[model samples]
Target: MRLQTDNDMVGKRWRSRALTDDEFDALSAASPEGGFQQTAAMRRMVEQEGAAQTELVGLVDADDKPIAGAMVAYTQGRFGLEGSIWLGPLCDAHNEHLLTAMTMALHVAAHKRGAISVSCWPDDVYLRRTSDGEPDGEPDDLLVGNYEKLGWHHAGFDRGYGSIVNRWVYVKDLSGFKSADDLLKSYSKNTRRNVKIARNSAVHVRRLDRDELGVFHHICELSSVKQHFQNRDLAYFEGVWDAFGDRAEFMVAEIHLDEYLAGWQDKYAKFAREADRLEAALPESKYPDDVRKKLDTARRNVESAEHRIADAKERIERDGHVVPAAAGLFMWHERELVYFSSGSDERYAKFYAPTAIQHEMMSRCLERGLHRYNFYGISGVFDDPDDPGRGVLEFKQGFNGYVEELPGEFTLPVDRIRYGLKAAAAAVLHH
Candidate 1:
């Protein structure tokens, strides 16, 4: 048989090469469904990932054409920690072949980054099943499947231990250790009033900008320093500000505590004030025993609610991005709204912005025909009830969102021997 005269038989489109960082950014920025396309954020992620010791790889086509990209991160300096490096971004055409190539790209990216193996969250990646019925992949549906096809070992399923499934952790060890789902189940019955208050409150939502970033960052800084964590710089916030585009929005729930609600708060305050008046008028020696206890109770309630109202008022006048008080990042996907990140103004912890935001957003999501409103991440730090961070967990607990055991991280072995040696050296050094 005569050999083919032309080489166009390989692909409908010519097999152009890959993509570099600049090309990747241009493609992502031009995409309609892209998220956070700001250059600063990409650089920041690159920097942070580097600090985490991740290998950030950018590829390109034969004529310097940028077509695809991926990241490789080696955690704890162990082969176990080394894996496909990503900051959770997807912006390709997303068909079957392109999908598998992305998986293959992961292998290349991580391997080039010095990882003998790579790990990732099983993000809708297709996995094929063995004759024994294990899920393996062709990379046709998702990335996870490609790993299996490429001879990457399976570590099994896992879960997210919080309100939103984003923070859900999954571990697949080419080095031989995987974390499973016995770790995931459901939500506890313990919730708080703020959750409900935010759930049921009236608030508005809008995407803010660098102008408003200062206030948001102020709150974040206060919360961070109070809790002992490092906060990123203004430049980083600006990147998030630009990248989110329409997707990046903030909410302001006008607890409009109607004249009616305001009246109620005032009425309560009046009662306490009158009691105080009585105590001041009467000498400690002259006041009745029950009167002192009653007066103390009133004072405590007022003090507790004092800041919450002020916060609501400030949000309405200054921010206009308020929620019932339980407000957060509402992840919207295919008619499903997930509650991602959440926070409350200390002044209105009594009003429960946390609950207000979740409940209201849930209603909005449902109205928008979304099936689920996810409360993103939660604290596993509750092992000690008194852990200072325990309060944040409790704040999340108020909403009563269902706990989903999402499959966590998984990995594939690339340079097994090198990875094994790295793992051993790490364990010994750290040990």
Candidate 2:
């Protein structure tokens, strides 16, 4: 702990200091607002990358118990060493006193480290939004005003993804549901049908060993190319796995080609038997019209099953005994489970493997007694059908979740002279 400051606010005294890893972990675990981003594991990941130096700064009570804090990553840039506070200061964000003290503590800590300025994208909600990105009620304008009053420069609410962290996200509240069936009842009809399709198709989801990260990476890369999105390198994921251990899960949905083919073959036989029975009964039935209609439907089912069986056999011959169709990485913190990065092989998209992967993770979340499931980022545009992100939004919405619009990023100047100089230079370069 380098610098300690004593301050009095609202007739109570508070202190700020550098916290140890254990201290930070305790604070994060105890606070409902705490998340994966502020964990000691996150700090370890930053260290492993070697691109930034991480500092865990906290506001403590008289007993030295942390009331609020953040994990700040300092990186040297062309302007100067700049600090970033991502998804934190973990505390009751609505508490103005704590927020003010946290702001002061960050300034002191960053300046002491010779940083010119600090940038923060606090993981605090500015609006409660419906699945369609429309406001559920009123916006939290007071929060923005409070930050500005605390001497932080606020970026006005903007549409789309234009910040280091997404200003918009989708989350599901899992507290009300008691079982997987209850959870399934909440999903859209299409989502439920797709999940059933994947399950009936013999797609199985399992946790991948660390050595199989290359498999996940390959799927993610393929999906990224098709979706036109950037993806992290393998080392980034490996670092996460090493740091978070069991708290991190890399899950893949796979199909045993032989078993899948067998399943289809059985379906074909069942459909053929039903159609044959209906056709034979039709000649003697007084209700011949209804019997003929049933026969037609059953014949169509048999044809569909035959086609599926043929496709399965061809896939088995070409792709070997087992084939991975989709992969997803999930981070489990005490408060919630975050659906992090994911990828799928487009060739097996008809398998609906991603839906199965999501279902499996959500079931695990309910078993763990967690209340929140974060589906993560989405572009703020919800109404435009032609928007590039429409498909992404629709996919998440199928699971029945709401949207959260967070206050955009803010910058707090540590050293006014250096910060001003850097800002001037940035403006000049842009022009």
Candidate 3:
């Protein structure tokens, strides 16, 4: 594919072509904002799964060194063939000429490959944000304006959770924090309390090897059933593990049965002693009714603690020493650590295993000297109490990170008539 650009870039020499596996890996690793999604391994996984045809398109300078690149996955969409779903384009944000040239080249290549439309979700590094971390609003409009000038249509801000990607994300800056304690100080009080609870409850967090994918998938299945979300099959997760390799880590939280049971038994003993003392003094106490009620509550607590101890003992006898409670997969790229996906067992929710797992991951990020930790995607709408994603936002918010609203998605139409026909057919089919 030849380079296509406006007259402004006429003096610049640009070459557009397919990048080899080595070239793709080298460039993606060197990209300032690229993550695992832009890697050659990811493309290979997509192709191997037969879900899409992968293409690594690069725009090279006169020296033949790539200045900008994208991993475009060609897949069948509801409306015709969707070509070039660019997760995050790897490019220099400050170079307008290079950005335009690369955008044009991608569209040209997509059209040649019979793609009806090409859409892109630019990397978040290109967005401008205020010191307070909110979207800079009009100042950030320049980023989308550049794409529009390249003949791409702004798809508008995506408020719904369903379609599109990269509308909003939660990010925590880890640059200033020196230790886990320092980072914990920045978290909300509730988050801190929950983490403490999990720690005191003997919830252990550890990294899982690839061989343990089954264990992680089991927790994900339980989480999916409880959260009302569809769970990806084990094969897909295996592919992800294989693709990212060292850059990825799957961490699972487990509760040690012996320790947990012992703690419950100790609590039961303490509550029993307190209940006995309260009952003995109930008749002589000035507030007789109040003392009797307190005694009753203490007795109930002792019974509950006893039940928990018995349950834990039974589980230990049948299942062994530890029980998995929650799991999360993380991807580390350059100075950023991304929380890619996570799931937790609803049965262990009372232990706050999920929060504890996240805390463990954040500490690891700090130890590695990562500058930022991304919580990935979240719906931007937070004011509405009834929004389906409100709980997600609230959970992420407890980590004390600021919300980042990206420029959103944009599309360049290659075959308007075919696109329209397919879209109409899809609408009718859905109706």
Candidate 4:
């Protein structure tokens, strides 16, 4: 792919060309919000699918330095093909002129490649944090405005949680927090309790190696089946693990039944001893009913703890040393650590493994000096309690994260007649 130039933009000479792997990597690294999606490794994964023609188009400055670019996977239309669906585009939105020029050149290239329309889903805008350390709801007007001015039409926001990319996200600022205890303070009271519950239950969380991809995939499959959602094949996950390398992490939560049982047994013995001492100290006639009730409560706690210990022992005797409960996949780039996917075993829901896994990851992010922890996508609609995504919204809300509304998807037409025809065909097919 040779360099294509456009000298029409006033005062600025713009050019677009295919970027080399090193150039693409360097430019993506330089962009403020660029992620692993725009990397050469991702391009290779997409190419492996053998479904579309992939290109790394770079927008060069006057000095020939690459400033803006997009990794576009174009699917050429067959017969009277009219348009192509371009996946997420990576570009620097801070520079308006360069952004406009690059987008225009991309449209021209799409047209030349027999595409009447081109669609782009840009990266999510990072909202600022307020004084209270919560993420502020600030829109990226300059970026969205540039796209609108260039004749890109905004697609409606995601509904029923059925979009390739989410238009709304939840994020937590982890910059100032020094320790896991400080981070826990930001969560809701119930979330804190859940984390404690998982910790006390002896659930251990750790990152998985590349060889453990199958284990994570199995957990994901189980979750998908129970939740009635579709899960990608194993190859997709393998690609992500391979593409992101150190930037990606798969964390799994597990439990050792013997250890949990031992802990509960120790607690039971301590409670029993305290109850026995209190009963011996308080004479039946001298002590008030309230004082006697304290002893009774302690005895009841001992019984409950003993029961839990017995149950855990039974489970350990029947099951193995370690049992997996939940798993989550994360990606870290620059200042953001994104929780990309999660899965858990239905049987272990009582263990609350996800909470522990998430807390551990957040603490690790703080330790590594990351600025923010992104909970990724949630539906913007929160009014209805029965909405499909309401539970997800509530779950993320417990972490004290703030909502961010993105500009969403946009489509630009290079050939109006062909675009109209394609639209009509799509509508007819839908009917």
Candidate 5:
């Protein structure tokens, strides 16, 4: 449908309509505001699963080049048809005219689909913040005001994880990094130590194929249960793999009991030999006290290695030759590599598999020349030590990144009567 601002009667002609898959791909990829949720692949994935009816809608200029776009999903909610946009409408938020026209087009599109209302949480950041969740800059009230002027209802800035999508994320900038070693050097000391420890413990990571989705799903299930959070099943992961194809990577961090045992066994023998030689030399050395101290340290190292070897043997007997310690899902984009989902088996927490997986993914991002590694989603509750998100924040902090606070969601009531009725009915039902 043709869309134009009432005030710009003589401006360039523009129309909003359904875009073809290829059109959406090229347009969204070029749009600075575009994200994975606004892609044609995401629409196909949702449609294949019968989850929602999706439209790849866009506003195009006279030459038919897209000026703005969104992947809108319509699902029947208790209140009627509910439409949502995940990280879009892909357009320059600074241009009031473009945003206004896009919002109007979305309203018409959702209305045509019989939606009561449409909600959007754009990818634009609203404020700059430190990694610790401390605000570092002023909020963007101008952008919020622009949406309000377009008759969209601005949702209040609610903290924590209540939005349809995460409003806060942690991202590491790899612009100056030349290699994985450079990225590693930028990490917090503890993160570097954890990566080293994981490596020393024989934790290794490898990419999984579509057929191995269940292995990653199992890891997710275990992690969700421990965290008391709900998790998606195997089918969902398979769907993601099928939809994203090579763009999605599922990696598992595992430990081989035999390898672990062998490494420790060799270390133990070396430590034992060192201790024996040191003790034998203690009687003849000019620095007798130093020799004795060296002998004691070598013996302690031997004792530790023995304990580790015994533990590896026990694990081999109970868990076979290899054990999957953790798994992570990553989505690749030219702008960044997103750490979408991840979980670790608490039983193998000591192996620090999650940290290893993160280091591996970040290294991959650097290899691809991507500057941003997005550790998506953290609750905006840094001051509250009792908050469940505190642990998540701390884990991400070890990698050294800044926090991005996104503008909250906004809604446009396509059918006011239906929207109000649905709200009243819901209130009465709850009452």
Candidate 6:
């Protein structure tokens, strides 16, 4: 091993060679108590997307003893991130301090790579939190306490860079956007129910197969240029479909509309314009006024097409998407099925697509012996009723889940003097 960083009493020894797949696997297996940033997922991400020249590991301390396990340099869509630091198959005091030192080492590597910023997920804290059944806490609370005691703003959370699944994207921003409380609050009671309603309505969740992928692509492509559409390529979905398919399910629920059974009634008379075309091709005497009137009526019906489209949308929801009173939900995992995304024909508003989806999903999961009914996401977080998207905020709040607050993000600058101040700030705001 070759030495890379030192902090007086602590000296970081990096691997003399790059990690091979076998080495990565062997060491990770040895560290059984690993997580998000230290597991196979992190390995795949680093190997696939990160710059390997800067991936850091460790060797010794001031006593010159070897440090166990690994560290990684990760990136996301051109953004630099500090990742996985595992403490072998065990935990110890040295693990904590060593991780702190490793993070600094990575910051040096990240900044040198022209990275605008550097960050890590802090997997050890996550393992503790998840294992302890405590999902509610600030982003930087555990670590931020130390960071605050130093001097950097380790408690910065960019709310707009939020996730549909609350707490999924805990972040520490180095530039642009501050933490917005609106993005942090838990979903409201009624909004949770709406998600339940959608799930309870006997909607079946199915991933789009290869054949259906084309249709989804078409719809998505057309939607992308809309005033609100974001840039996403067909290849992106294909990759996600491949990865998440093995671990996460792609689910879309469908409800059958029964309105068609009582459909197709019109006040206007039926007419056709074929005769008019033929008449125009023939002698003028061949056409009659009655035929002309019939053609004109048909033309008027075609011109009024938008109204029919709207009517159909309303009928589908009113007659379809509805669940019987006793129906329940399914498809939740880990005792929770989040209604992360849903959409339907607007005309079926009465059929309550949004409401049915959530309710059905929750009910199904509950039947399977699950616990929480998550409505997933909400925006806008002010006591003032005048905040933009207050309606959406109020809607989600209807579900009656706990309103949780968390500490935000913080950064440990690269230089030792700067990092010391960052640690000071962490101690102040947190512990």
Top candidate on lDDT is 2
lDDT (10s digit) by residue, model 6, range 15-64 = 22234544544444444333223434444544543234335343344453
For model 3, how does the per-residue alpha-carbon lDDT over 80-190 read when each residue is reduced to its tens digit? 578655566887645667777777777778888888988788765444443234565444766776777777778776665635465777888888988998988889999
Q: Write the per-residue lDDT of candidate 5 for residues 1-431, one digit (tens) a residue.
A: 12344536414557787888888888777777666777888888899899899998788898878778889999889878899899887877778778777877788888888899988888888998998878889998888888877777887887887547998889888899898888889889999999999998889999998888888999999989988889998888899888989888999999987888999999999999999999889889999988988998999999999999999988999988989999999987666788999878898888899999999998888778778888999998888889998999999999989998999898888899998998789789999
Indicate which candidate wins on TM-score: 5
Consecutive 10-residue window with the lowest summed lDDT within model 1:
174-183
Task: Show pairs that collide, candidate 4.
Answer: none
Candidate 1 lDDT, tens digit per residue, 1-431?
Answer: 00122223313322333444455556444433222322224444545544445433433434554454443445555333465433233424244344345555556556565567766543332332221223344433344444455455555553214221243311111111121111111223334344433434443343445576655555556556666766666655555445444454555443455532464467568866866776785566555777778767777767655654674466557645533332344434442344444444666555554444444555454345444444544443435667564565555444433332323455556677876786678689988
After best superposition, candidate 3 residue 254: deviation in angstroms?
A: 0.7
Q: Estimate each model's TM-score.
A: 0.52, 0.95, 0.85, 0.89, 0.96, 0.49
lDDT of 2 at 185: 87
Better of 4 and 5 by TM-score: 5
Candidate ordering by TM-score (highest first): 5, 2, 4, 3, 1, 6
Error of 2 at 6 (Å): 10
lDDT by residue (tens digit), candidate 4, 69-154? 77877766743433333234666656656666767767777777877777777775635443222546665677777777777777
Instruction: Pick the winner on lDDT between candidates 1 and 4.
Output: 4
The runs of at least 3 residues in candidate 1 whose Cα sits more than 4 Å from the true structure, single-residue gaps closed, are: 1-105, 109-117, 124-207, 252-327, 330-338, 379-394, 413-421
lDDT of 5 at 128: 81
Model 6 residue runs over 4 Å out of place are 1-99, 108-117, 121-142, 148-202, 214-231, 259-345, 359-377, 384-392, 415-431
Query: Once superposed on the true structure, which residue ranges of model 5 sit more than 4 Å away at CA?
Result: 1-11, 426-431
lDDT score for residue 112 of model 6: 61
Q: lDDT per prediction?
A: 0.46, 0.87, 0.80, 0.77, 0.86, 0.40
Better of 2 and 3 by TM-score: 2
User: RMSD in angstroms, candidate 2?
Assistant: 2.7
